[model samples]
Target: MTQAVAKEPAARPRRGPDRYVPFTEHMGVVRERAAAGEAVFSLELREELLNNHGRGHGGVVMTLLDCAMAHAALSRVNYEREVVTVDMHIAFMGPSTGKLVATGRVTGGGRSVCFCEASIVDASGDVAAQAMGTFRYRDAA
Candidate 1:
């Protein structure tokens, strides 16, 4: 006689971030796509992410924007050079819903800094938020 047992499966391995980021990991932000001057990320809407108004928290939007912009900046150097956010401005365009996708693109920059813009689109493909940011390349410490 043999006993059969089935245990829960392990978590799926993700391609994930190039570098460790606590907040990004905690927020469950997934890297959808990325390139030299562009990046895309997504987050599944959950109760934990909602605000008092029952929509995605503004901070969540900002976090996604920041991460996306930073990824875009890092990709410019093939994910070798690090970067720090110098400034950011974000505008919320609509209520967040379902899964959200954030897209970031490098507009322009010099050797020391990168200028970027990012936008979050709701599941319906409507823009929910937009952000502009400047990131400076960090000198290795």
Candidate 2:
């Protein structure tokens, strides 16, 4: 008897993978989940995403953080609004050996910009990376 390989279902499309203007084209990062106006982004550990120690790459981590923070900021805005990253800083704590996910949310908000943070955890739920960011709001319709 031959075993059949099961395929996963396609994701529902709502918006562009990258909502930020500058990083819009870099859909290289994947948005695995989104709900409650929040987003969870993930990516498989690959050689390109590995550092000298064969762990999660810093650039990859930064990208994830930026996307997560941006999504979080956008979520806080009024109807049909956008935002731009003003300042972002990420601190890498440990190595991520497998698939990684970043959960992001807005910590503070105002008329101009919002403050956001995201925690990038490994499959084991260990905090591998974290980021703090600020975003400038765009005009809303």
- Flag regions of model 2 displaced more than 4 Å: 1-28, 35-37
Model 2, residue pairs in steric clash: none
In candidate 1 the C-alpha lDDT for residue 99 amounts to: 93
Model 2 lDDT per residue over 1-141, tens place? 999999885554434444333342343567765544477887777786688999987887888888888777766653256677899888888888788888898888788888988999897789999899998987753
Query: How much is the lDDT of residue 29 in candidate 1?
Result: 92
TM-score for predicted model 2 compared with the true structure: 0.75
**Candidate No. with top TM-score:** 1
- Model 2 gets an lDDT of 0.76
Task: Give one digit per residue, the lDDT tens place, for model 1 in 28-117.
Answer: 999887797899999988999999998989999899999899889878777766788999999999999889999999999988999999
Name the regions of candidate 1 deviating beyond 4 angstroms. Answer: 1-17
